[model samples]
Target chain A: MENSVDTLLPTLDDGIKCSAITSTDGLVLAHTGSGATLDEDFLGAMGAALFAFGSKSIANLVGGKMKDIVVEGEQGFVKVTILNDKLLMVTVAEPLKLES
Target chain B: MQQATTSISAVQIAHNIEKRRLFIEKPQSQAHVTNMKDAPIYKTRPAVLQRAQNQDRTPLLKGEPVKEVKIILAGNVGSGKSTAIRAISEIPVIGSDAKAIERNALHNKESTTVSIEYGMAYLDNSNLHIYSTPGQRRFDFMADVLCKGAHGMVVMIDNGCRDPLNEMDYYLHQHGRFLQNYPGIIAITHFDDNNTDTSLLDYSTYLLKHGLACPVVSLDARNTLEIKQVLMNLLLQIGDFKTGKKRA
Candidate 1:
């Protein structure tokens, strides 16, 4: 099921421009498409940092689990979707219209 | 007759001497000076009490000035950007509808901001100046100018729309470059719609892939309480960034 989901990621519409499945520990389980040339490892580290921040924020505030997190920037948008207890689906996209 | 005249002269002389004595004598029976230092010790002797009052007065200085935080609201058109700003503002909001002015698309307005929309709010006793840019694409140039020097950004998205992902993309393309290092919030507005299909998890994954380490919250622009929570979350994120602590 996980492999099928991974294969479907790259073939997914442009709206899901770039996709990745990362563990709660911040390790990449699957990634499709290219990211900014800055460095994949460095980007992974940053993603972990963000995940930690989001998780902690939700936990500390509402005393609930963090289900999703989104960060917008001038170059692109990053979305972190919580799948189950220990996995997250991440996607990066340029300004593409999901709705007409 | 001579004797009577001498007597009158003597009486007049006695009266004049008594008057002179009264003028020269100082009252000695008044309260005794408790301490030598208590004696009127003016640095300079005054010719008169009125003269002492005219001496140079001490200079007065102004008090310390108050500091305020500036927050910028930037995003794409129909993103509820203005409503998001209004949510946190304590004062009345001043906004413009740029779509009304430039009916044509080809001729872009040189000044993207037709009018400025700003409001003031107090968060944690800290004064905040919140401003929103016109979300139209033609006004993007003006939005960039507005975004410059902002301490934070609140990027709003319409969640119920057919293409929220696309809206996210537009926001990134427009402000992602400038806001790469700055802290921000992704507000998914219009959640009250019946056809809302996206979940919080779906949105979060989208944001994680981008370089932002912020919170994605569902916001109902019309609800003040919900807005306050969103603002609190934004502040918490900012505090974490400054203190180098994990948000949790």
Candidate 2:
């Protein structure tokens, strides 16, 4: 499980800052990258929370399951994906600069 | 490029609001309230939401534009905060109760509130908007958001938890500043009548040590009347606070 989370960092581009496998209730199962700056526990918690809120909104409003949610903020972007019924894969990446 | 970024930000904000509207829709979990003819007035009025989001509780005291009385229910996981809202709310409660995938060993409940749960009850010719915060410690931000413009707050502590008194202390300290101005009530739920290990007086003494004057009561969250009585006490506290007659 740790290897799976660790390998994801290398596969992605340099823009990727951190990644983690979190439980549906926001517990960090596996994590890698930028441990010095980013708090993995806080990241896992917020990721689970964001996914739960998105999934619930989709289930209640449109009557379907949420595949993923990408939130683009000023500094970076947070991407959350449903890995299974009970787990989620959350990735934090820097803002994608458009090629001029 | 800056213009493009700004536009995208606006779109993202709209997307978030759309989700909020869908969740808060009066009918049974419908996503779009825009088409509903009898949509809630609070949902329609953006200004009211702005004020509430800004943590403006003055309107409730003045009895002006904000027609609803906002109250926040906050506590630890599995403390029956959501159940209390469901019991007392007249409308179908808007809930985001999701599977509790973590801390299973600690808590017996399978689901936990990940986001805020909203419910409304019409009482005393006014709408009492009850917002219950997600009980998990990580979702404390949701609780703070719901605390915006709240007339009163109720901290529901589960008597059956491993350390109920410590739990009460944590929640009270978390919202201590807010409780100092607004009314705060502590209702001990899941009380086993036969279990006399912890008494109501114990809670009162605990509060006194913390220099908090919030009222403490034992309650069964599933009982609608009992929940209503707790809410009534909160209302009375609100009244007392407004008149400068709050308990010492």
Candidate 3:
């Protein structure tokens, strides 16, 4: 199943440097792209933590479901989207560099 | 719990409002109330959710405001996990109770935690979400689910129970990693009835010997003042952790 996820990442936009599927427990199941300089393990753990925090905070405060979370850093951006009850998809990418 | 009352009427804060001294030891609270005309306006109740809605949402990545803190209560049957919550919770605790079964029936007062218990307290506009884990081991699965992302925990130990030191050991062993990841304290319940060969020092000694430094305190779970002390201690420890102070 992870192999299937790995096969779908190259089709993303050029700025989409890294994409991976991670379990809710912080385990990286599959990966593609390389815009991220940090280790995949660290990236996966971070994705899990961010998702968990976002989901729980929203659940308790807003009392609503969390659809997705986007974290932007000076270096790059990390996007986490829920894929299923037990898995989330994280995309690490650079800014699109506006056509200005 | 040892103090389980069939009718919570006796423990109801609305009825005991006059009786609540509101902990003179509780800093800022006395002054805050006195400056507000000395009339207690906010009757500790469920409708008052201590949540701060005015958080700066500067995009998703910069930072997220801490609207509340989650704390878990872990202990065995009759450790007063239920009563402590009732005594201190500003809101009516939301949970079910059932008649005790098996060896638990011998523990005196009936009823077991049917599910997670929730209570809340407001501190500096941030909500303190208190959650109680069921005492039965069969409910371990539920404990895992309830404990995730909790900022800290207060592990209650019925010191009068058989070999309470071992009980403390068991709980810490079960959650040592979790506590290490977060701040936690040891609350000795049933201290008045404690007839054991050990004292508070013994518990502290043992924790120190085992390389654990979680603060230990004697508290009557039925007394709101003592419960607040325990909560305040844990809160301070969490603050200390944030500021790089040595763990208490």
Candidate 4:
């Protein structure tokens, strides 16, 4: 199922730009799409680190669990969603139509 | 042999013995000495050493003081952008609580952002003020207005959605031109759901291809330490810019 998800990722219309299945540990289980070399292992680790930081911040503030996190910049946008205990999905897209 | 023994006569033997005794008994001269007894005496002068130490350390306190950093968070809706801002803000953030408002004649109430949310936090004694603008398209003008004088920007994206990259393109379209000279950080959020092959480095490469000169960090807006690290990196970037400006 995981491998199949990985394959389907590259096929998700080019508008999707880039996609990755990262573990709670920030490990990149799979990725699709292109343009630029991405280090899956490092991103995976960093992803976990990001999750821990975000969750801890919210917890410290008594805001409860983190539902999702997003970041936008000139070049593009990055969205992080907590899918389950073991997985997170990260998506990158053009700045246009991101809110939609 | 007996005649040879006479060569070292009683007088000469007595002279040698006397010379040895004098060499052994006489104290060493003080000219080349380090004055071991005076060493402890000098140690007793703690006040002088304290003053010398203070003189050596006093110069560091005389420089330009730290300036507060202003951070502006700009992004599209559902990018978890607001949550990202809330994560690092030290003060209470004023934001909407998922309420719907009517937009037009259709009477279609939407959970739109009514007012801007602002918060502040301190990063290692340096103040950081963060603002979250409405993510709706209608608020683009407002977003641009709020983003006008920011020292840095944190661009967020949602990874679970189908067309996440469009958010990046939209940001570039609306704010990229102005931010061309600004230092920014790209944060990829929502890593727990969608399964894709793209990596953060790949996303970073895409940004660089679009002519952005900054670091791309994979971040979960809910994590505090991760957010702090990102902020730290941004602060370092600001420091670098100041240094470059001073040099120029």
lDDT on C-alpha atoms for all candidate structures: 0.56, 0.70, 0.67, 0.58
Please write out the lDDT profile of model 1 over residues A1-100, one tens digit for every residue: 7687677354546655567776543456677765675343333334544565577668767888787888998777888777876566777777655556
Model 4, backbone clash pairs (residues 3+ apart or across chains), number: 67
Q: Check candidate 3 and list the clashing pairs.
A: none
Total clashes in model 3, counting residue pairs 3 or more apart in sequence or in different chains: 0
Task: Give a tens-digit lDDT track for model 4, residues B1-248.
Answer: 00111233456445433422221122244345364322111111233223222313223346645468888777666666667777777788765432333334112334444336678876644678887766655445557667767888887766655655666667765766555556676676766664554555456546545555445556678887667766665665565565753211
Model 2 agreement with the true structure over A41-86: per-residue lDDT tens digits: 7788788779877987898889888999999999999999888888
Locate the minimum summed-lDDT window of 10 residues in model 1 chain A. Answer: A37-46
DockQ of each: 0.03, 0.45, 0.02, 0.04
Model 4: residues >4 Å from true position, as ranges?
A: A1-100, B1-64, B96-112, B245-248
Error of 2 at B91 (Å): 1.9
Give residue B230's error in model 3 in angstroms.
0.8
The runs of at least 3 residues in candidate 3 whose Cα sits more than 4 Å from the true structure, single-residue gaps closed, are: A1-100, B1-67, B103-106, B243-248
Error of 3 at B103 (Å): 5.7
Give all candidate RMSDs, comma-separated.
32.4, 16.2, 17.2, 27.3
TM-scores of chain B, in order: 0.62, 0.69, 0.70, 0.65
**lDDT for each residue of candidate 2 in B142-236, tens digit (9 for 90 to 100):** 77778888999989987777777888878877787687667777887776532336666577667655566566766778987666656655664
lDDT of 1 by residue, B1-248 (tens): 00111122445445423432221222353256453322221111122222223223232223523336667776655556566667767787754332223324312333222334788866543466888765555345456667767767788877756677776767766766544556676777766662556765466556545434345666677776555555554554455546665522
